[model samples]
Target: MEFSNRTRTGTHDSHRTEHDATRPGPMEEAAAVMRCIVCGHRAGYNRAVVDLATGSEVGGLCVGCECTAFGVSLLFGFRLSGSNCAFCERDGHYAIPSWRARTVETGGKTVSTVEYDVTEVTVRLCDEHLERLKRVAAAHARVPGSVRPSGPE
Candidate 1:
């Protein structure tokens, strides 16, 4: 059976079905017909990833959304050159850096230093994904014992 991008109203569990070598599997067919979550574009060519955490398909990621959803993750000394989202492999639009800060006693005085922990990491986020990421980060920040001390007493 041929599949097309259509808004399925009722709840349906996307299942996989085996097919002959000449035909595509059920999962493959579903992916081809999936629509983008942000733009509602028919993602026949630009298939998005499935959010395992939420058990739903995500589609139509613009550069901003792709960047926000994936973000970048690189070593401290590395450089970024690509415009792809690190998490979703979509085009990225931003380069956001994450830092790690530490405070230490220097010459009997307290001094603070910041390290670019995610030096190569870039931030590319769409409006939706950016807002979602920010919300999640804020939630984590509010949790007790979520942030750990960098130095020992």
Candidate 2:
């Protein structure tokens, strides 16, 4: 979500406040590193290089049991179609990197450098998956509305 600091005069004192929009934030981008929405398990993943070949899943089981269940939902085409992280398989959690292609003029020559920027996307979990996430989170001491748990488990 887009956040902006707003300053307004309220009667006597000038107040500065932060306003959040309906948008994805940096935490979502970082969390997309390889988290399973169904169970909140995170692991390293090797991304698929070509579309023709199916990706490989070799990581250990996630903390949540419903991850496998979610996989079943995805298998029969029951999932609502949308793009998700290739690793975590959760939509909106991953931030698609944007490549900036441009050139700058040097003292006497032209130099080009590609810049990469990561933008987070808001992914919507299916109802069942969301509920499972909530239960798993609660079990792990994670609070609702707060994505990160308060302390080390």
Candidate 3:
């Protein structure tokens, strides 16, 4: 599903406030229809899906609040899960490949976008996790000169 740029409106887990400055806006309707990568559950009310970069809620299966969080943990290992570096946070994914390759439009003013490669890799993860990440990256590969996520004006 395509991501949405609109702010989210709904109740969330006690710890997850929709207004948190760190969380991105809510998932668009399209994203809400996606099945959880971890639990295979369709996103329902209050699922814990979030942007993989930050563990903030994006959208997830309504049946369980953990689908979004779990899916990201599986794709990108969590610090507390004791998962290996293959799934752990890394520096590569957070780097913007090149300076000329990014841009941003903020407050009606255009600016250079932040480029980062936040994925981490370690030796201990199983091959299955690595393969999963590769597939994920392949699917999300953006077109050259495509804007990174912030929507049109």
Candidate 4:
């Protein structure tokens, strides 16, 4: 499931504003340092070589010489399929996708350079789990006009 920010109209000195000053930003983040798929180097993709999506600079081949060689052939939005359900080991009937903010550290462990990315995680679900998920989602969603829970087909 995806989440969107909600804004409420406010009056300041009888003037309307879209920016909410009272909204506090996240004070802490839960993150993990995942290595690039192309190279085992901790900070390889955008640091050692250019990112195909974003044209930075391909200075040279990465520590793992196979980065560009194999990376170039992969499609832009690649994902794994034919997997079991995320909740259980059953043939997946539907794809469930969620997105989150991610940061990739570059310039090696010595430097503090960072690149931002919106990472998407997709999981497959079996029919039984999917129905349960739908019911739970509907129950949790109190706002009207949201995706209503589906009935039996």
> Global lDDT of each model?
0.38, 0.32, 0.33, 0.34
lDDT tens readout by residue for model 4, 1-153: 221221112122222245633432121111113232223224322322223233332232222322222243223544444455656778655442322234333433112222322223334457676556445443534446643223211
Model 1 Cα lDDT, one tens digit per residue, 1-153: 111222322221233234343465443464446553443344332323333234243453333333333433222333444545444566543333432344555555444433222122333333345456546544544668754222211
> In candidate 1, how many Å is residue 153 off?
24
By TM-score, who's the top model here? 1
Clashing pairs counted in every model = 9, 3, 21, 0
lDDT (C-alpha) at residue 96 in model 2:
20
Candidate 3 lDDT, 48-140, residue by residue in tens: 333444433433333232322234453343333222334455421111011012334555543332221222221222435534643543344
- Which lDDT tens digits does candidate 2 get at residues 1-153? 221111111121122134332332332233245444334455212110111122222121232333322334432434323455433565433222222344555554444333332223212343344455547654654444533322212
**Model 2 lDDT at residue 87:** 34
For residue 4, what is the lDDT in candidate 3? 30
Model 1: lowest-lDDT 10 consecutive positions: 1-10
Candidate 1 vs 2: which has more TM-score = 1
Question: Each model's TM-score, in the order given?
Answer: 0.28, 0.22, 0.22, 0.26
Candidate 4 to truth, TM = 0.26
The lDDT leader among the candidates is 1
Q: Which residues of candidate 1, in runs, are more than 4 Å off?
A: 1-80, 97-123, 148-153
